[model samples]
Target: MKVVIVGAGIGGLTLALFLHKAKISCEVFEAAPAIRPLGAGLNLLPHATTAFSELELLDRLLERGVETSEVHFYTHHGQFVDGEPRGRFAGYDVPQISIHRADLHEVLLSAARERLGDEAVRLGRVCRSVEQDPERVRVNFADPSGAALPSEEGSVVIACDGIHSVVRKQFHPDDSAPIDHGTTCFRGVTRWKPFLDGATMAYVGTYDTGKLVVYPIRNSIDAEGKQLINWVIEVKKPNDGVRDWNRQVSIEACIEPFVDWRFEWLDIASMLRATDEVLQYPMVDRNPLPFWTRGRVTLLGDAAHPMLPRGSNGAAQAILDARLLAELLATKEPLIALKEYEATRLPATADIVLTNRNRSPDEILRIVEERTGGQPFEQISDVISRGELDEWQSRYKRVAGFERERLPQ
Candidate 1:
């Protein structure tokens, strides 16, 4: 059976690679005329990296990205609350990788082309709509200029087109609206000296005041030995209803909220000033759909479940979807495979979507903030116990399908 995959982003390309490895024929079609190095930093949890390990591309990714060692939580007052080891450092066999979105895409795209041939990925084909019968699926496409392109036929169609998916809209038009979280996030990467062991992922403050997530994506560049540090600032604000991912905004808008965020370990204000550019995006996600499959076409990744970027599970969950769907499609009948993929992944990812909205890993900071009334504490233990902190972390991991014991060996 042949598969037609839409959108050559992380999910689509990874699916292509997995399908090729499974000895299944597939092709990827992307809307953009070319795939360029875009997007900021994202993390691949141990579970996500396990799929890359199976693809034999983990080493290349490791060579380009940082193996995150630990994750730490702090308060708006810059007081340390709790910390834990991650990936191999957390006793998992695979390591959690923190890499630039572009670097990871490069690795996947390069491998796909090498293995599946360059022509396997068709660029500039925007999916207008999809029509399928019992025999086969037909995907209609248009060029970036709105000119019609030849429709492609395949046994099945998988939509990985992201939050603004055309195929998803066609299937579930009533659920097209995004649930705005009433928050704006500012993200950027800056060249700076490492902080807190060089590989630590740090989350500071609560959403009511200001929240900042900081980590290094690329290690050591140039003569001064500065790492590429990625930082995101999330603040509760009225949603402007804009969803552009590359919306550039002044650095002052991002720094005003955290003017006094100068901690003993890292000066958050200075990091914002040093950033060359900052991209702003509305903190938005769609409510979980009742279903993600109908006939031979199914949704994957952001198309299937677009969750808030809270626990760094966006890309990781998509990777999980690709791995599982590819395996099922290779072994089971195409129609049964699509149904099973939805039955398995839809509810699982739906839980993540709701959990991200209500309680995420960062909820630890929120809990501490609420318990202490957002004040500086003389002692962390007096504010929250170690057991409480561990429980919060473990709960999020389990819901997101990355619990140490739950992961497959």
Candidate 2:
């Protein structure tokens, strides 16, 4: 059976690789004229790393990314709240990889091309719509300039086109509006000396005040022995309702809120000042849909569920979707596989979507902030107990489907 996959992002490319491994033919179509090394850093939890491990790409990913050892949490005052082990350090078999999005995309793209052939991915083809019958599924595409392209026919069509997916809109037109959470995120990368073991993912402050997520994506880039540190600052603000990922903004506006976020360990103000470019994104997500499959077409990744970019599950869940759907398509009939994929993933990711709206792993910092009234405490135990911290972490992991015992051995 042949598959026609839309969008050449992480999910689509990974799906192509999985399908190729299963000896099932597939082609990927991307809207962009070319795939450039864009985007900042993101973490691949053990669950995601496990999938890559199966594909034998985990070691190569490790070469380009940092193996996250631990995660540290703090308040806006720089007061230490709690810390926990991650990936293999947390006893999981695979290590959590914190890498630049571009590096990860390049790895998947190169693999897909090498295995599926260079012509496997068609660039500059925007999916205009999809039509299907019992015998086959057809996908219509247009160039970036709105010129029509020859339609491709396959056994089934999978939409991995992401948040503004055209297929998703055609299927669920009325309910495609994004829900804004009144939070604006500013993200950037800086070449600087690492702090806190050089591999720690640090979370400082709460969203109500100022939330900063800091981690190293690449290590030892220059003669100064500096690592490429990725940082994100989230603050409660009015969103202009634009969802462009490449929206560039002045760093001064992002720095003003955290001007005094100077800590003995790492100076947040200096790091922001060092960044050459900063991208702004509004924290938005679509409410979960009732279903993801319609006849011979099914949605994957962001096209299936666009959850708030918390808990780092946006990419991880998408990778999981691609793996499962590819496996099912390889074994089951195309239509049956589409339904089963939705049945298994829709509800699971739905819970995560709703959970990410409020309660995520970072909820620990929010809880401590609430309990301590955002003040610096002499003893962290005096505010919240260790048991409470563990509970919060475990709850989020379960919801995000990355609990150690639940992951594949």
Candidate 3:
């Protein structure tokens, strides 16, 4: 099947790689004039890493990123809540890799070029709409000046355009603007010495108040033995400003609430202040669509379901979507393949969207904060048992399709 993929993101690039692997004809179109690495760091769980393992890109990702050894949760007061091993340390065959979004994007971009050829990716093509007949689906594009460009034709089109997807909008024309869940995330990267074990990922505080998730994305980028740490500050707001990911705000405004985030393990306030740039994004998501596949067009990644970003499944689920869609399309007829892709992934990702909305692994800190009444406890066991904490983590894992037991030995 000849496939046209909209949005050359992690999901789109992944789909491109898989299509090439299957020797299926496909092309990737991106809106941006140039694909620069954007956004912060993200965790690659085993389920997501499995895609990399199959593609033989796992080692390259780990070489540039930190192999997450453990995950730690702490209260806003800096008291420990609970900790657990991750990646191979958790006994999963694949290691959970943590890396900057830009680095990961570049890796995927480079691989796509090498495997699919340089001319495979068409940049400066912003998809405005799509139309499909019985034979082929075509996407209308616009140039940088908003001038209409020639429409591209393919057997099918997959929208990976993210939350602001134009293809998705064309399908669900009246769909209301993205529903804001009252949370705003301020994210940035800072160079600092390792706090806990060098490869640990930490989630401190609670989202209702002020939550901080910090982890090292790159190791030893500077001469002073400092690792590039990615941190996020999330706070519940009655009203949020713009929802753009690259929206810049005063660094002081971003770190104002985190000013008192001082801890023995790491000085949160200092780290927040040390960052050169801070980008703000509203924690927003759309309700699951009734179906992702409509005729010969479909949605993937944030376009299909933009879940709350707390659960660390944003990119993971997208990667999985690409893998599955390519698998089905490589076998079934174009139209039937789109339907089968939706049947397999729609319900699965929808569940994760709701799960992340209600109670995600990130809420482990919120749970402890509630039990302790937002105060430090003599013992973490006093606030909550280890079983409860383990349940929180495992339950989300199961929903995200990465539960250790669910995998084959």
Number of clashing residue pairs in every model? 0, 0, 0
TM-scores of the models, in the order given: 0.98, 0.99, 0.97
The digit string of per-residue lDDT tens for model 1 on 1-409 reads 9999999999999999999999999999999998877879999998899999999998999999999999999999999999999999989989999999999999999999999998999999999999988899999999999999999999999999999999899998788587887888889999998888999999999878789999999998768878999999888885688888778888887687788888888988888799998988758999999988989999999999999999999999999999999999999999999999999999999999999997999888888899999889999999888888888888998899898898877
Q: lDDT of each model, Cα atoms only?
A: 0.92, 0.91, 0.88
TM-score of 3: 0.97
Off by over 4 Å in 1: none
Candidate 2 yields a Cα-based lDDT of: 0.91
Mark the regions of model 2 whose C-alpha exceeds 4 Å error after superposition. Answer: none
Screening candidate 2 with a backbone cut-off below 3 angstroms (N, C-alpha, C), the clashing residue pairs are none
Clashing pairs in 1: none
The candidate with the higher TM-score, 1 or 3, is 1
Q: Global lDDT for candidate 1?
A: 0.92
In terms of TM-score, which candidate is stronger, 2 or 3?
2
How well does candidate 1 match the true structure in TM-score terms? 0.98
Which window of ten consecutive residues has the lowest lDDT sum in model 3? Answer: 236-245
Q: In candidate 1, how many Å is residue 373 off?
A: 2.0
Predicted candidate 3 versus true structure: per-residue lDDT over 1-409, tens digit per residue? 6899999998999999999998999999999999777898998999989888888899889988999999998888887788889989999999999999998998899999999999999999999899989998999999878999999999999999999998888888888788887777788988999888889999988765588899999998878889999998878763364777788777877576678888989999988888988988768889999877889999999999998887789999999999988899888988889899999999999999999887888787777777878777998888888888888888888899998887644
Q: Is candidate 2 or candidate 3 better by lDDT?
A: 2
